[model samples]
Target: MSLFARLAFLMLCTVIPAFALASVAVAGSECPAVDANDTQARNSLMYYVCYHQSSPGEPAHTALNPAELPEHIKWTPSQGHELVFSQTRSVYWIRLNIRNNGSERRLWYLNLHYPLLDEVTFWRGDQPEDVLVTGDQHRFGSRLVDYRYFLLPITLNSGETRSITIRIHSSGALNIPLKLETPEEVIAESNHLAVTHGLFYGAILVLAIFNLLLFFSSGTTYYFYNALYMVAMGLFLFAMGGFANQYFWPENPKFANTSIPLTLALCALAMTFFGRSFLEVAAHTRADKTLKAILWICAGFTGLTLAIPYSQAILINTALGLVIIFILSIIAISRWQQGYQPAKWYVLAWAIMAVGALVYAAAAFGYLADFLARESLMQVAIGGQVILLNYAMVQRWRLLNDKLLEVEQKARNDLEYKVHERTAQLRSTMRELENANRKLATLSLNDSLTGLYNRRHMDNILPDLCAEARRTGRPLTIALLDADHFKAVNDTWGHGFGDTWLQLIADILTRHATRPRDTAVRFGGEEFALLLPSTDLEGAQKVCEAVLEEIRTTSVEAPGGAKARLTMSAGIATLLPNENQQEFFERADSALYEAKAQGRNQTVIADT
Candidate 1:
């Protein structure tokens, strides 16, 4: 075509390629370079991450290839060790453009500290053979290293730069902490964790066994619950610490993955029952019902963790755990406020444990960064709780023993004094017996709810009143009152409100029956009887109308902020000479029916 045209085309191509390479080099400068002689591990290396929306059935490797990954995603760089994605289904691709600054070949371990990830694929450069796939979702044997953490061994040549990419996906919290460590560092870290975890789980086991024995010997339910709590907490921490999959069920990936939430749920359930019993929650009526409800919810949640997805289950379990902690704290504080001495220790112990648990949960959900011994903080808190609870148990036993001794001493003193004061003691006993008989008689003669004369009182008093009216030749009348729409009130406003309505009616009857010879009686449900002595039917009717008028004007509280008025139907009957008490009651009841049939809220006198 032409010499100048060809030359310009070649120059343009060369300049454009160089400019692109320079841009990449500037971006790569942000990444950290590893030196073989470095003594410390590198956790805060600059890395670029991108997320891929993958379908459910897609394989992790095929979801996004490293070569074709950046078509739609822009690589975002994150500084420090804040690699937290809370419980996601999307695949994350993390790229580290690292250079080996040393002059000699060096081998390093890329450790992913979180082992609960479902799938993790790490590779150096673009080669498929360099990829190593391992996570808790796979068999433990598939991991390159035999450690609890996912450790991949990588070799770097002297003065070489390579791009390391990691693909991670999980059905749990994706709070991955990645580190580049030398073999010595890995060994040291592993040894430190082993010693700490050994002590942690070992303490839990010992406490469980000791409390179990105590439960068998003493038959105390709190001890049994505490033992179960210890066992469940130990298993849960074991699973969460990645030891369960490594040592217990290496080949059973599903069980290993499920164990974390399952054991945690069981731990929560056990703690709920233990708190209820240890705190003596049943002593408080509302708190007792609340804890009972929590027990049922915890049990159902524990079973639900088995069937639901791990992400959702773990979230719900954390929330349930927090709720239990709050409820127990409230009960413990309430007991302490009421001067229950042992509740002080429970409050202190649970406070420490709750703080630790909240911090641990925050760290796990990526709210807090890892600090010194942060992972083991919960274990320490639980250990403190166990010791404090055991101390409380001992103190309670001593208190009980002291009370028993006091009771024995009092009994001996009473025996010694019995002979010296026999006459006075007998007189006091007689007085006490009389007082108890009076109280029992009052209770039998009165309605428990309304505190008015009951049907039994009516049966005893009506015959005497009729006989007296006949002897004295005084006009005696009885009024039977029934509440209008009483059943409808009960059905609409609940039985408790209906009870209140009955009490209100009883009060009106009481106000009208103020005379010495007048009596107010709760005959049955929603029906009241009033006996007026030395009064004619006219006087009884006037009293009844006044009572109905007061009831109609009195405001009864209804639902929805509206006020309601009450009404009643009353029938009056006057005793006749030679009429029996049964005949008098029947006539009064018939008159009441007549009043109700003639529309309620009015009084009708019986025909003599």
Candidate 2:
């Protein structure tokens, strides 16, 4: 048989016997019919006596009539033991035998208690042989389903007997007493197994709490769903009797029976919810709807099982349905892997959960028994599922964080690019503005017609030169020149030819005035001035003579295809320490009038 089938078989075998024992009843009349004094009175009334045999390879057996057995088969009851029988009793009594069949020596004990009477006792015997009584004496505690067997060993030889006696006393009446048998070794093994299972359960609980704290801190949907998932799975592990309760509530026998299936159902539901949210399934694809439907179906079936209690049938159907759903999940994962992005994590997580589920199912069904020290194979399955789901949650978080970083980086890069582009544009505009400003400055200070400094430029420089000459006690000269008969030339040759003649004279005067500090200006119509720094009247006269010679030699072309010769009359004046610019210019004007009177083609100097 498959592991799942074997597990189911074992579970049915174990659980059915418990149910039958719990339901057994005693006949009231049969209890009184047996002689209280006779040793066989209890045996005759006891319809069945079940016990673990001391020999290896012995199948569990029950005797219908213990009174007819040989001396070795019958065990003497303890003092004041009353075996009562009734048809309506709710508990059964049993005897178990323990033997040390291994090479190592071992200790054994029989544990039985009557909660109704508040009494507990232990029976110890030798290694060769013994018998033990283990049952509820007064119908207290939870109703006894079956007797437990314990193996307590200090030392024993191979094939030695580790046995004890158990006298079952009943408060309620029962006609036929049923027997429950289990090896002492099996019970000891179970306790140790419970301890290990409990530890694993604690681990899962811690993980759940950690994730929950993370959820509150981060406020992320992923952390919230992950926390829920871990809590659900943790509860499922606890319900399965893996961890804490084994040490604390081991006597609360109904915990695993009642809570295991319910927790599993709820866990599956929570996992479905977690998967949807973590994968962003609804936003990403229509497959989320299908998953929801599957979740609903599983939930519905689980609810039905809870609402209607039945023995084994409900459990079987639920398990089978879950198995089918798991198969479908596998197929869905294959399909999801083809194209869905979120499915990458969803499918991987489900795959691991699916395998864990299968292993759990196998153990639940009694298909494969656990050989481990502290837990059943099913508990291991639960632990595995918890780990895989946790890892998957982390993976989902990482994927989201990576995507967020990518978007932020892109935004930053785009912003930088725009800033750089704007900077380049601003630089281009600045260069254009600088060029225009330079041209404006040139136009403001230069004469357009004569290509010489304008009167405004000369007026601004002359004051600075005057101040410097007075401070340094240097000679400064100002010379005024006027083209003689310039108006008559314009009349004869047209104003255009007159303009050409004036341009020629301006060029000659500018070229002949050869000092860095000299100022040449277009003073007015047919009038010009040159200011010379660091020069006396004599130096000024020499500069004026050069100007007069150049002006006389230079010829201009008239607009009417005629040639014209130009000459200018010059007047020079020197500045004294006390002479102002107006006084100096008046003196130069008088000299220029003298030169014009003297026939206007020569230079003249002002009287010192």
Candidate 3:
């Protein structure tokens, strides 16, 4: 079965489950200390984990005013526990107290750590009306600081207690780990995180190069697949780490949000193939079929990520990805049981990656909470897994090289038949490509509606047609045709009937301008043109009369079954000596205006 089909079946058979830790709360006793002269300037504000949920229905925050919050709102001491809630539309309320007991009042910045939250609103001081709002969903300008994480700075007075209330909500996982930081601490930590992410990407790049070198040296498809897997994982990691938004494209949040599924599908595609190759599943009928289906599905999914909403795509991708990883792990372990040594490493690598992915996915889905679960845990797991997989590929290459040498010692044999078969395949592909190109070239020149030369092709051939008239000394006739009362028909019967009327005129022009050197063009909108290389104004007028007669005889039904007859007015001009194509065409256009002025459905020959 296809991976999509299998996933649908699995989803149908099993209930979608959510994981969430039980709420821990102690009323009105949690506070974090602030000192001006502290050597370590950053503190985890792990206290006052009070929550008032909304929409999904929990108690609303009673304490909008900081001065009287202690009396009205029950504050829950977090006991250094992480502030986590599952993916909810409900606005969560969290409160914390900061006391600066030092001689000097100091300013501190508070960062919520999670970057993907949809909204973060902070209330500080005695003012009930002041709220600082910032989040990924908000414009970048809304944040007090120019950072990816939600950050707001607050001032602490000496020997004074300050109450802080934060309201946060998201369409994604709500894992809030707020930190109190001095200016230096925030800068130092940001730098540290940047270095860590840089190392992560650098490792991926080096590993990709290492595997590609192995491929070049060993000439094995194994190395190729290994390199591809690392590259895809690298892309996924860059987007997941928020580096894509931070450095590459800060302004485009939609692209940043959409990049998740794009990279996820890429990594998923690589994993499906790499696992299949490592397990040698193609030799097994049923196992190979599953792997192939997974490969195809992941490829299709990567393309679909562009058109679908990011939230829906991310949810579907995360769920299906977990299922695929589980299946691959099972396959690897099964192969190891069958005595495949490479499968042993495959299982180990898959385990590390699977655990990390599960942790990240859990946090993303609102089942898991903690900064470790959301960030560092998965990065460590992926870093370790990439190393293990690289080692595994090297081992495979080593064994393969040994086998190759042993085989070489026995004999070297090849056949002309294999070359012949490959050559025949190449020939067939080439022939098909040539035919397709020819068809495309023709389609590019011709108008789809009228099968006449479009303006683009006419522009290309106009100079040549002008040159031909000059060289042959033939009276080259240029006619610009317009459907009479075209706009009136459009107004009466709508655009569909208008198109029919234009097509009827196009057909009449095609039949009348049928000389070997003549060309018919649907120049633009309702305007048609004819180029007759050897026809004078008199001869062109005859052709124009014929077109007029055809239009008079022909009739088409409008939308409401009204008989619609379309007539045409045209201006015919023979090429003038020493005049360019533009000048000649303009003179013809002037004549067309004169024809419209004289009467409806008549030809006016140019006197210029």
Candidate 4:
């Protein structure tokens, strides 16, 4: 048989006999009655239980006429403990017959201790339409009584008998512990539970903060992982206890249902990594690989829970949790047996926690009886695990410190040699830094795409070049070249092709300005400038003509296998005596416009 099938078979084998004996009460017995004089809390009061699997939306009290109701025929007698349906998507209806046996009117509170249930609805058999609904699936304000657990007020007039039915449903394990109690009794129980939960949460917060501080001080990554694990565990407990629904997001039903599985999955994921770090299993290659696989599985489950339905998510997460617990326990034991001293405490700590978690899971799946308080049991187990882990960490600290002291003594003897080696390394680093700074300077001055001097570089060198030309009386020519119909080329072919055309133009310009004093500049988009220091206007025009001819002859392939030619317009100006940089550029710019005005793909020279 498969593992799940074998588990189911074992569960059936374990529960069938007990179920038979507990359910062997008088088949036709009416619901148990509560007396007016009874002041104590009644635990596990017997009631009739019926399945509402056929039509989940239909109430259990569907019979219109009072005489049509089949109280003893359809409903089975209770087993005198919490009802356990295991994990299911089915709705269950519980019937309780209450009578105010005494003369005076009686009032009592009905408490359902299972907080994770999605819905709990209460209604009188006579007035089924008038229902009071409350559960984790609904807003907290909708509860019949202002309490975390499902608390409903019941009033019976003197000498009156009323049949009450509760419809319950959940996506998780369904285990309902019913109790009839007085107001004082319910308040006392709530207070006690509140204090216990407060301490548990408070300890989790304190420990998480403490571990975070340790991580910061010691620079240990495992301490940070442990802190995350503790926080996730605390949140999972909060969700399981229904405090997330009650106190956190009271109005969001989706979040309330999602938090339980989501938090548990996250907790498991954190535990997986924390275990890897705590055990330092990397030295054992096989164990490290196994933990890596487990970590991925946990992560997958965490993500899957967010997208799947609550019913499937909870079932999968619970099963995954069991598997993880088993795997961690085995690894811890194996490491301990391998003479890893620190793993000794981990083995014992996780064993207690694994056993506690197993018992709780078994009870959830109906494989074990709900005799013990499962939540409290797991909390105690976690508390014990935390204490043991604290001691283990202390031992780890001492071990590391001892190693550090020995290393320090050896390091002192080699300090002088190490310092000389570091000095050599520093000199090499300074040389690399100088090279990097020179490269950065080159990058800042050049156009990124065209690999030519940019406008900023042109601005910096033009004034000095013009002053030298004026002092020596040797002519300096400035030529501006703009691609003809550049926008039309971009619109026709695309911007990518346009960028390639600009790079081709830049290459042509670089070829003509090959002399030591000649500089090529890509002033802006689709525009090129050549600064010729010892050349007059005529020499500059010949350079522009050569560039234009090369570009015109060159053919580029467009998107549709068509060859397209390139064309440009150029304007040349020779430095006039006493001409400023701006005037010199503007005269060239005007000549470039004149070239465009006369006709594109031609060069024009300014008046001397």
The TM-score values for the models, in the order shown, are 0.60, 0.40, 0.58, 0.62
For 1-608, candidate 4 gives per-residue lDDT tens digits of 23453354344333331242244435553555645345442543643333333234444345433344455444556655457765665666677776677787777887777777787778765565557877877888888776778887888788887777777767666777777787888889889988999999999899999999998876677788889988998998788777888889988988888988898898888888888888878665888888898888888888888898787776677767767767877888888888778888877888788777766666655555552387889899999988888788888777766765554332333243543555444322433544543465477878999999889878977887888888999989999999999998899999999998998888888888998668899988898899998997778888999999999899999889999887999999998988899999999999999999999899999876
- lDDT of all predictions: 0.75, 0.53, 0.72, 0.76
lDDT of 1 by residue, 1-608 (tens): 22332233233222221011011222321344544445442644424332233435545435555765534444445544446654455677776655677888888887778767888888886666788888877999988889888898878888887777788878765666777788988999889888888887898899899999988876678999989988998898788878899999999998897888788889888988888888777655999998888889889988888887776676677767776887898998998898777888888888888777776665564455552245678888888988888887777667656754553332332233543544344322543544544476476878988999889878976887798899999988999999998898888888988898888888888988988668899979999999898999989999999999999999888777667677999999999989999999999999999999999889999988
lDDT of 4: 0.76
Position 499, candidate 1: lDDT = 90
* Residue 227, model 4, lDDT: 91
Q: Give the least accurate 10-residue stretch of model 4, judged by summed lDDT.
A: 12-21
Candidate 3 stretches with Cα past 4 Å from truth are 1-44, 56-77, 125-131, 139-141, 213-219, 307-309, 412-608
Candidate 1 global CA lDDT score: 0.75
Candidate 2 yields a Cα-based lDDT of: 0.53
In the range 134-231, model 2's lDDT, one tens digit per residue, is 22222212222232222222234556543333323222222222212234544665577557755876787788778778777665566666666666
Q: What digit string (tens of lDDT, one per residue) describes model 3 on residues 1-608? A: 23453355345323233333345544543455444345343443463345545555344533333443334444455555676765556667777666676788788787788777666778885464457876656655677777777777877777877767887767665787878788888999999987987887888899889879877865656677878988887877676665566666677667777887788887788788778876678565888988888888888888888987666677667766777888988988887898767777878887898778776776665556664445778888888888787777677667766764543322211223433554444322433544543465467877888778789867877787788789989888888988888889889888987877777777778788787668899978899999888888888889989998889888887787778887888998988989998999998999999999998689998887
Instruction: Give the clash count for each candidate.
Output: 0, 41, 1, 0
**Best candidate according to TM-score:** 4
lDDT of 4 at 583: 94
Stretches of model 2 off by over 4 angstroms after superposition: 1-195, 242-256, 283-286, 310-321, 324-328, 331-349, 371-376, 379-384, 409-608
Q: Please state the error at residue 138 of candidate 2 in Å.
A: 12
